[model samples]
Target: MTTTTRGTMHPRFDEILTPEAIAFVAKLDSAFAGRRAELLQTRRDRARRISAGENLDFRSDTRHIRADASWSVAAPGPGLRDRRCELISPATRSMGVHALTSGAQVWIADLEDATAPSWENVISAQVNLYDAVRGRLDETREDGSTITAEDSPTTIVVRPRGMHLCEKHISIDSRPISASLLDFGLYFFHNAQALIDGGRGPYFYLPKIESHEEARLWNDIFVMAQEELGIRRGTIRATVLVETITAAFEMDEILYELREHAAGLNAGRWDYIFSYIRTFAHRGDEFVLPDRDHITMTTPFMRAYTQLLVSTCHQRGAYAIGGPAAANPTRQDDEHRHRALALVRAEKEREAAEGFDGSWVAHPAVVQTCQEAYATVLGDNTCQRDFRHGPITAQDLVSLEGVPQTITLGGVRTNVSVALRYLASWVEGTGAVAIENLMEDAATVEISRAQLWQWLHHGSQLAEGPTVTRALLDRVIEEEMAVLTRNAPPERARHFEQARDVLTQTALGDYLPGFFTPYAYVRYLIDRPLRMDGPLSPDDLRQSEQVATPVTNGSAA
Candidate 1:
């Protein structure tokens, strides 16, 4: 099958989007697209069942897989063994430099949620990695002196787009391909050998995976890509993010399926919260989450999830990575800076103290804080297989009845402000931004909007007495928009307007959308397939009026 690129091109994109690479991606897509579709349908069916009051429990069929104690995942591969602290950033040049020089043990070059997945980004990220692999990055400092990027000891991992998305820009026989395959295939095809030759490998961080079946699919791809590329079979390694509520139950099964290729699991806080809301959104108010800000790592149910991850990974002889501190101290004011770092240190200290082999930091600014905590806890930078916390029950996984319902108008306003600002940046081609000094990405937006939708759906009452209604949401949004867009130029203000439309449709519509990215990507990111031979015009950046529904149905509650 021949694959064609429909998106506008940038300089040197041809180097990454070559015919050979396209063919490789097409091959993987052809093999897996049917299974991917079936799995997506299965997700919908399972979600419907749960929404209809069916309960979630560990799969009876996969019980033996978990009960068996003889099996274990392969040990961590090169440059990944001691992941004391890793950096997560968009795969952009500037961010890449900061990540590499941040002194973290691993740099996850995020092409998934942290990236906008613009075709330019798709190509440029590959180009950047292609260069970084060969030690060819050259940049000039502010003082006008050029510095070759450090050949840092940090390992590199790439996160592909999740299964829910497709790379519409690249098509096989006029059909779009899985964004996951496009990302994984292209990166593996181009750089696997180079990485192998350098004693590193084409490592990946799988995202938003809900089942061990998905992990099996990735393992199959790893086998095929390595065979096709003529690399060793076990050369590739992947750390799965147990982000979704469903995935939290299948941690052992997921590892069992990817045992040869599985590196470990990372606790994904925001997406886990988002998934919890979406999975149980239609349930009674008992399940309605409080303000997202209140859902801390120590929250009873959340602690249960993380404890399961740590116990599961250590039991299988794999690394158990923790969530990021995500505090960019550089963005904090002086008074707030000390407080932020203190909070960051405390958070990292808890993760390390809990026997997490390592953790993540969003910005380079907090890498040392993470390292300091881990270094003090894990002097040798390795974990014993003695994770003492476990035996977490299904009720523990699904328990949210105990959390206090502290919904407030302030929480509502915060969600609106965050969703609008983050969506604006995402549609404008950036995926990661610092909001109030914390790293705000697609996952954060998901948590914020999903909580908003859940509160409004359940008619949850705020501490200030009024119930959540469309009128209340609209009023808060209007007040927040004025603050967000004040002193902005026309184009800038219009961007914020488009962002409001996105938030309205995703958060206030009759039902909550599965994700805001796909919603906004179709309405805002897609443009006519015109060549980018010149500068982008106003027509290029504007949202598509064809699908512009503002979702203005009001409620009187």
Candidate 2:
């Protein structure tokens, strides 16, 4: 074998990680690893410039790409014509079953924020996707029920890990490979042909892209993968996540770069907020965001962003998918459930009115609500590409003045507690957790903690009349840690401590790190072997406590 598997072996995993598959990924690593490193370094360099009083604006050099009017992306690929509702979930066996049956137009098999990059998670997610593509995901459960689709199955679109991460479990000649390449290569190599035969293309939602050149890299990768697999050039379709402020400026260039394989662009609100804070972490209070709850879609800056996304996508003949609706209907209260559904419907109503072709709902219960909202706007139509929104400018995109800075002690406490709980679950190999009727993922953790750092960095005042001090942060974290430590089982108490370690390292540091996932993954989540002979419950996360420590503090990026 040309590659190494540093993780445990099990049934069906070997099928996914065959020698050919590993070799294919190894080739991809050797080819693009240099460029990936250079681009990541470029991000760090750009961040340094932003920190040194440089503001974000449209690139002068890429003006022609935006000014040109004759270009349009390829038509919507198979199964992507009407994406009015897309269900986003991690690729666990059960979750995969539910998502495919949710009656949504698309199911984004997310390997990024919705998943933590544990060895067991990274490999087994591929197994779920493999079984799903082959239509055997639900042969028989131990409970003896067959997985049934309520209607036609949803289209599957995979979102791989960002370029900044590494797949430490599988390596080439003692060197780790890019996690992005591994996820993309394994899926495309194994299932591209099968998907095409089934009348669906190998689709993807690209995440964390910061520039047009980065989009170009993905385009070249798609081209080469198709050629290697003997598929057509434009058979692979991708939707770039316009989540970063930098990418927001270059949306035109990004779509142009991947025009042949481009599906559309999505308004990723959570990560965009995280990026906003991180981009301006070194600045004064002008950029400090209030509580995450207060920063709704109606905020001036967010409206500017969504308006720009819709116009750009329509101008380029691509679908403009909106952000998540952020409500779960599973909570057990008649009044509360009705209220949540009402809010979810209203949110989708606004998106449809603003010309979004589709929107995301985290749970199955809200699917019909989203569908109804879009149905009103797009009756018998697949998308709103014909509808056009008015124009916007660069200053409107970056101006945070209209947002009310109602920072409160409650907000600080909430950030600390939520960050603690979410990080704990993340290390336990459960990426999506339900807390307070909302499903929280890595993006939740990013914005939660980044807001803390940004507020503290500026000494912003809380509504309770005290400045956000390191002492205040330390006290709040300590209190939240005590609550978590008390509630945790004896075997799982260490996870809480580890969670606090990650929080302090990321949120309370002198310099704000670009992302906490890379550092935390390398330090704590790197090579814990799981007894994957059966489906794992939350209790099984502590299967083996013996682990080797990896170097942390932003080195993984």
Q: In model 2, where is the ten-residue run with the lowest total lDDT?
A: 548-557
Tens-place lDDT digits, model 1, residues 252-322: 99999889999999998999999999999998878888888788898889999999999999989999999
Model 2, residue 102: C-alpha shift (Å): 1.0
Q: What RMSD, rounded to one decimal, does every model reach?
A: 7.0, 6.2
lDDT of 1 at 505: 75
lDDT of model 1 at residue 448?
86
Write down the worst ten-residue block by lDDT for model 1: 545-554
In model 1, the runs with Cα more than 4 Å from the true position are 530-557
lDDT of 2 by residue, 328-400 (tens): 7787499999999999888898899999999998888899999998888888788978777677788888898
> Which residue pairs in candidate 1 have backbone atoms (N, alpha carbon, C) closer than 3 angstroms, thus clashing?
none
Q: What overall lDDT goes with each candidate model?
A: 0.84, 0.85
